[model samples]
Target chain A: MMKVVKRTYMGLIFLFLYAPIAVLIAFSFNSSKSRSQWGGFTFDWYLDMIGDRQIREALTFTIVIALLSTLISTLAGTVSAIGIHYMGRGVRTAVLNVNNLPVLNPDIITGVALMTLFISSGLPLGAVAMLIAHVVFSTPYVILSVLPKLRQMNRYTAEAAMDLGATPAMALRKVILPEISPGIISGALMAFTMSIDDFVISFFTAGTDATNLSILIYSMAKRGVKPSINALSTVMFVTVVILLFIINRKSEKGEELML
Target chain B: MRMLAWPYVAWMGLFVIIPLVLVLLYSFTSGDIHDMTTWRFTLDNFARFNEPIYIKVMADSFLLAVASTLICLVLGYPVAMIIARADLRYRNLLLMFFLVPIWMNFLLRTYAWMSLLSPNGLINRLLLSVGLPKLEIMPGQGAVLLGMVYNFLPFMVLPIYSVLSKIDRHLLEAASDLGANRFLTFWKVIFPLSIPGVISGITMVFMPAVSTFVISALLGGGKTPLIGDLIEQQFMSDRNWHFGSSLSIILMAVILLSMAVMSRIDANQPVEGRRAA
Candidate 1:
């Protein structure tokens, strides 16, 4: 009896969670423009979404920003994580706490704070400002991800390499880099995901110069329902599911390598 | 190796520290941020926020956030308990389902609720078809609260579930041996043990819900405004950076104060059940 009740309750919660998503996916294929009424199924909205110039621009911006931010943050974060790992405890804790500021603060505050910085510094709000903001927020996550892997590592291995014939640079490249590569990969993935999905921060910093998919969607959603948005949501949702599944499978085999 | 951290430390100071300092600088001064000579230190911005209308925005933001956090706790605790008690083989899969919605764009998830709750939308259409009166929740506090609960439910669930699943079965067995019934065992043993998770869950949900402008803008239909909206207006529309910075400071203070209080409560909990064997 208890098991039955539990199952039913879980089922209802799942239903509530997925109902909106189901409605979105189903309506993406609806031939009629109306969001409420169901019409005959069609792939026209997807095709329309594909053909839309504004959306195409937004998609391009989103991908470029995500890729760039992930690449830069991953490099900077990994290097800094190594540095912090070797630091004296007192300075390390202070820097780590500072690093947590962006992570801990609300997005709105971060957005406005960065906006004020950019404006005060005389940097115009646009793609560059947005890119900078992304890097600022994303690098801390990379540091967090990489720091743990660094801790788990045998610290003496690199010193052993250095004490032998290996140069310091070579020891870093050949020994330390490979050991923390898993953390780097996962951190890159996280940075990419966050950059792509960010709306509130991007909304503030993107100005009128650049529009990511998220910013575009917000604008469209504000104006009213658009079938193209429904189609876009369906595509993005499927992509996320597939990507997460692949990541999950890889991490399961590797063990504690992904966040 | 520590030398390599300097660049990033410098970068953080420029981007993270300096910006926050500028917010503080702007909040206490009312003039162009660009021109130092134009700056005049004053508390007028915060003083302006002392008005009743603005206070109501803060109060409403708090009330709504609290309400949503409470709802999420009530709904999510049972789900967490069920999942924690499930077979190990099925546990990850169930947790994955709960988290999938969260990976979707936050805006898109909120947008999904917008479509569902709108007048001619799914819920009302279903209600009309069933010969029931239309449920007019959209463009109101109800819709905004629903959006908050929906988007943040996973945060509440994940933490509690982690703590619950890690709880030692031996503790429950010991309780039962002591002549405690299941209900009594849960109240005395399980609930107290889960306080840390519950506290973190509350912080996670409450912080986002209180500070979000998106849900209030979309679902509240501009009829309701939270502290986030007021701050957004100052920065984005009104171009009143002074007032915006003040509001952001208050929001940060509220979050920090609550977090401090939560940690105090967490620290005060009995230490026995907190540790898992």
Candidate 2:
């Protein structure tokens, strides 16, 4: 009886949280202009999304930028995490602070700072700048995600490997990598999601020729909200929600949670 | 090792550190919009920002952020507590609902909110159909506050849950055995001990609330401009880098000052000094 009541309460809380989003998605296919009528389900909006040139370009650009940024940041972050492990207490703390500064800083401030850096670096404000800025901001997340797990892994394992005459590369590739594989995978995903979902930072860095999905959506909303945006958002939301569930399920099977 | 470290240090200094220093310097300088790059040292921008508009906006941002933070606290604390107390079998499900939203595209989230809150959208339509007065939600500060709270709630919850879940249940049982009721024991024992989680939640929510731009822009509808919108306009449309830099300097000052205050509060919190209080 107690468990049933608590479960019902949990259901209600989730309903409150998700009802608005669920309703919006349902209303997208409504035949009327107003959101009142639930006329019928139709594929018109989803069909339109595939044909729309702006969304196609924006979605492609956003994914490409996210992928590149995640790849680079994972490399830098893993290295930084490794280096941080070897440092003394004060130095390690300072480096960790510098790494985590991006998390505490405001999006708008980072955006402006990146813009300044690009202009000063004489790099044109476009895809390259966005990629660089995304990596710079996201590397800290990758570091935080992976480092504690690295610390948790038995240090003796690595020392034993070194004593067995393995090179740093060999030990990292063979022994350390397998132990912290979970962290690396999750860190990569975190960086990927963060880069892909970001609008503010990408907006500041991408001057032209590189508009991301968020920018496209924002511009369309500025003009006016449309049923098509609702359609696109519904699809995106479902994809992410399902993906998150799958990831969590795998971790529950003793794979390890996203670090 | 030093050589390897040199590259990263140089990279961070040139891009992150130097520009912030430049922002401070530029805030003290005066120049025309036409030639903002070439600065003449003066305190004019800071002086001009002493106008009521900038001052009021900063205060409004604080009020809005604080209100949302408080709501997140009330709403999130119960949820975090329940999750912490839940069986391991059910805890992950609760956590997923709280966290999966953070993974979805934020633009999509904002756009979804825009549709819900628009004039002809579900909220107003529902009101009209039910014979209730249509609430004007789009133009006001309330909508932005709601949007910020919704988007940032997980940030608040995660930190609190992280602390709460690790707490030993025996502590609660000991308090209960002493003849304390659930609510009273929570007040006397649980709440006091969870100060660390509370402070962590505060910083997690407060920092993001003060700086978020998309929700403010999407929900604010280009009117009732916050410092975020103003800074964006200065950098892009206004093309006045010096003034923009000055605004950034002031904004950074506000954030750093708040963090300082939060740290002090965290230090003097009851859990830190008196163990059994």
Candidate 3:
């Protein structure tokens, strides 16, 4: 009886989570334009998604921005994590607190603050502003991901490399880098996911010309979503599931990495 | 290694510190966008909250956030406990199930609810087929609350599960050995240990729910605007940056205060769950 109860509860929760997704996936093949009626199955929405120019542009921008921000933030965050690891306690504490601001603050505050900053600095709000906002928000998570690894490893490993007649850069590249590579990779993936999924910040920072898929979706949602959106989400959902499956498979400590 | 830290320092200063300071500056200033040169500092933006409408929205935001957090706690605790106690082979798969929806675009997820709850939506159709009335819940607070719970329940569950799974089995055994019933063991031994996870979960859910503009916009249909929508409207539609910044500052302060409280609870007893990221 207890086992049955548990199974039923789990089933219901899983249904709650997936029903929307199933609806989305099912609707992607929806032959009818109206959401209410399933006018037989058709691949037209998928084909239409392929042919939609605006969606294609938004898709390109989304991937490009996600890639760029992830690359930049990962490098900055990992390097900083190393640097902070070696810092005197006082300065390191202050810097870490500063780093925590974006992570801790609500996304709207971060979005609005960055938007205000972009305006004050006279930077035109567009892809560049959006990219900078992504980097600012993302780098902290990367730092956090890398910091624990740095704290766990022996501080002497990199120094040992230096003592063994290797140059500082060589020591870092071969020794320190390899040690924290898992953190770096997870951090990069996290940053990429965040950038791709971001909407509030992107909405504020992205100006007229340089909008991503999220911004595009928001606008389309406001004006009644196109069936193409269902197609788009279906593709995105599949992509993310595959990516997460691979990541989970690769990492034994997947739960902590996710945290 | 120490020298390598300078770029990070510089980046944080330029990007993180200065932008927040800019928000502070803007919150205290007044003027049109074009006439930034003559901007004068004033407390009027902060004072604007005295208006009944803004106060109502702010209260509504908190109310909704609290309600959703409570609901998530009620709903997620059992699920988390069940998953934690489940056989090891199925644990990862169960966790993965909860996580996959979060990976989908948040907007898309909310949009999914929109389709389900619309008058002509699937749920309504089901209701009509069952000889019941169509649900008018879509464009109301109930729908918004549902959306909030759906989106953030994972945030609540994951932390609690992480902590619960790590609970010392010996303690539970001891409680049962001491003649405590199953409920008593849970209450005395298990529940106390899960407080940290619960605290973090509350923070995770409440923080996002209180500040979400998208969910309220889509699910609430602009009929019920949360503090987030007010902030968004001020900046985006109304072009009132001063007011927006002030509201942002207020929201930030409230969220930070709650976090401080969580940290205090966490400090009193060191938590095994994920810390605030």
Against the true structure, whose DockQ is highest? 1
Taken over the whole model, the C-alpha lDDT of each candidate is 0.92, 0.78, 0.90
After TM-score superposition, the amount by which residue B86's alpha carbon in candidate 2 deviates from its true location, in angstroms, is 2.7
How well does candidate 1 match the true structure, expressed as C-alpha RMSD?
Answer: 2.0
Candidate 1 runs further than 4 Å off: A250-259
Give per-residue CA lDDT, model 2, range B1-277, as digits (tens): 2233445555666656765666666667766633557768887787777899888877877788899999889878877888888878778877887676666677667667777787877788889989999877786687898888887788777877887787667878998998899898888777877777888898888877887667788887866677787788888788777778888878878888888987897778765423532
Best-to-worst TM-score order: 1, 3, 2
**1 against 3, candidate with superior TM-score:** 1
Task: For residues A1-259, write the lDDT of model 1, one tens digit per residue.
Answer: 9989999999999999999999989999999998888889999999999999998999999999999999999999999999999999999999999999999999999999999898878999999999999999999999999999999999899989999989989999999999999899889988999999899899889888899999998888899867998998899899989988897777566654443
* DockQ, all candidates in order: 0.81, 0.47, 0.79
Per-residue lDDT tens digits for candidate 2, residues A21-42, read 7876787676665555566778
Q: lDDT per residue, candidate 1, B1-277, as tens digits?
A: 8999999999999999999999998899998756868999999999987899998899999999999999999999999999999986677778888899887888888898898989999899999999999989889999999999999999899899989998989989999999999999999889998888899999999999999999999999988899999999999999989989999999999999999999999888876755551
Candidate 2: Cα lDDT at A96: 75
Worst 10 residues of 2 chain A by lDDT: A250-259
lDDT of 3 at A167: 98
TM-scores of the candidates, chain A only = 0.95, 0.88, 0.94
